[model samples]
Target: MIALVDMNSYFASIEQLDRPEWRGRPLGVTNGRTGTCIITASYEARACGIRTGMRVREARALAPDFIQVPARPYRYAQVSSSIMAALESITPDIEIFSVDEAFLDLTACQKLYRCPVEVVARKIKHCVFEASGLLCSVGVSGDKTTAKWAAKQQKPNGLTIVEPWRVAERLAPVPVTELCGISTGIGRFLAQHGVYLCGDMKQIPISVLAGRFGNLGRRIWLMAQGLDPEPLHREVKAPKTIGHGKVMPPDTRDRQEVDRYLMHMCEKVATRLRRHQLQAGVFSIGLNTRRGWVARKLKTVHPTADSDPLIALARFFLENWWDGVGVHQVHVAALDPHPQACQGELFAPDHARRDRVLAVMDAVNQRYGEFALCRAPLVKRSDMPNVIAPSWKPAGYRNTLEP
Candidate 1:
């Protein structure tokens, strides 16, 4: 059996956890200030017709008395870590599905636990609430896909059981979009063909589905029948690629300033690769100039995470591809990075020394804050871009990896 643990109203719940009076009110956590979109809305706010991505001012016009709070990534991370730590006592075969959801494989423990899986699920929710002052839903099933759907069926501390025998009946009313690999576009296509729900799609011919969506159609057909051959990989997922990008202000024409931003992005990507114990061989640098979006990619000697190597590669890209529309945006991406790509040289020249210096710099920056210190070149105040999103905050990495 597998258990999918999904936190309820994750970002808004953190706000309610700290402020007791905000409970049972129409509440929202937003991206920037009042007029921006609501990144996360509490159930009370959802009930009042507020939703994610709705503009805050418009949401208020729709539902006037909505309470609001700023989204705090660190607070959400702290609570997530507490919940994950508590769940470690039960099992370690946890596959993180998202920032607020995880799948726990329990196939080996069925005989050990005398109580039912639903009962155990309830106990897990209770422990999480008691420990972190938060609420979550648990779904127990024969597989990860079904378990996730079952959990979402009832939320805010809901628990649902989905035995192998009950898969079809339980999933009958679910829309095709709720299935594992079926996207909103695919669901719309299926609806056009008179198949609106999972039950309706279950009767569709595999040949027909395959003809429509290619390989994805076959996967969707199997899911309609309560089947998925995909295995849950508990190991840290190797990043398919590492890249950083930022939108630029309109009508910008500073060449040296754009180069500095590219360097900063390269350093951030290199630092992330080192933390993951990986290295990259490919360089992908892109620029969105005033005329249009222009991109340039290049490859270098072996997989590496050292910032200097990437910086050199980026500089090469700029020299070759830069048309000088005064470039608006810049990005540095590491591609095809392999595990155990750590090949730092001991007797090597200033490269090795610079690598060590960067490591110490990372430690200091992490301890004090992201802007503790910097090199003289990129020290200007205009270099730091103020970004706001659903996350990407200081405290986003506090979670245990669910083993």
Candidate 2:
């Protein structure tokens, strides 16, 4: 059995943990003040109709007493580490799915525990709460997808066990989109073909699905039957890309400030690449401007993890592609590293020396804190991007929330 464990309203719950008075209040975590959109909302805020992307002003209108707190990535990371440690106590065969979720293989552990999987799951939940002051929902099923769906059936604290035979019946009324891989686009496509519920998907012929969505259709067919052959990989999969984007405090045409934002983004992206022991073969820059979206990408002959080259590339794109239109957001993305690639040419003069310098900088930053050895222009600033999503992780590490 696979047990998918997830923290409830992670960020907001963390806020309540830090400030006892905030508990049971409609609260949100945001990057900015007053009118900004929220990144996370508490269960209390959800009951008041405040959602993750809703603006603070709108949320306040729904619940006049709504409170918004700025996000603190480090504090959240601290809590996440404790939560993961608690889960690790239950089983070593664990996959960190996200900052707030993980999958633990209990097929073998149940015998060791001398209890059924459900009893073991209850013990895990109590252990997590005792360690982290957080409540989690656990779902036990034969596969990860069904386990995840079962976990989401209840909120704050829930436990659901879906044996193989009960998977289809339990998920019959659930929307197809509730499954992990079904995005809004996929849901719409399925709806067009008269498939709306989880059970409805099983009625479609596998050949028709395969013809429509190619390989993805087969995955969907298996999902409908609550089956996933994939196992919990002890090692997390390598990321296909590393990227970060931040909405400007105020939409502006100020080029210098825009350049600063690009520099900050490059620092973040490059730091992530080095942390993963990977180098980007290509980089891209994007902007959401008043004139609509614009982007440019370039491939590099030498894969590198230095911020200088990435910032220069980003500046080049901004200089050539930007039309002086008001900019709303800035984004930087590093893509497609060869799976076996790492630092190169240990004895090559200039190139190898530069790589060594970057490695030292990364070591310093990781030891003292992020950006401790960053360039002057990329120095820590109150408004600089510091958001760490569920997928963020450093190299040479399996699972973490530090960014």
Alpha-carbon TM-score of each model against the true structure = 0.83, 0.86
Top candidate on TM-score is 2
lDDT of 1 at 284: 88
Backbone clash pairs in model 1 (N, Cα, C under 3 Å; residues 3+ apart or in different chains), count:
0
Clashes of each: 0, 2
Alpha-carbon lDDT, every model: 0.73, 0.80
Which runs in model 1 stand beyond 4 Å of their true positions? Answer: 32-35, 63-68, 210-215, 250-257, 288-292, 300-304, 312-330, 339-349, 376-403
lDDT of 1 by residue, 251-369 (tens): 56676777777777887777777766777788788888877777766776656778777888877877887767766677778777667534554554546676678789888977995
Task: Report residue 353 deviation for candidate 2 (angstroms).
Answer: 7.4
User: 171-286, model 2: which lDDT tens digit per residue?
Assistant: 88889888998999999989988889988976778787789888888878788778776778766566777787877755679888789888877888777777766677798889
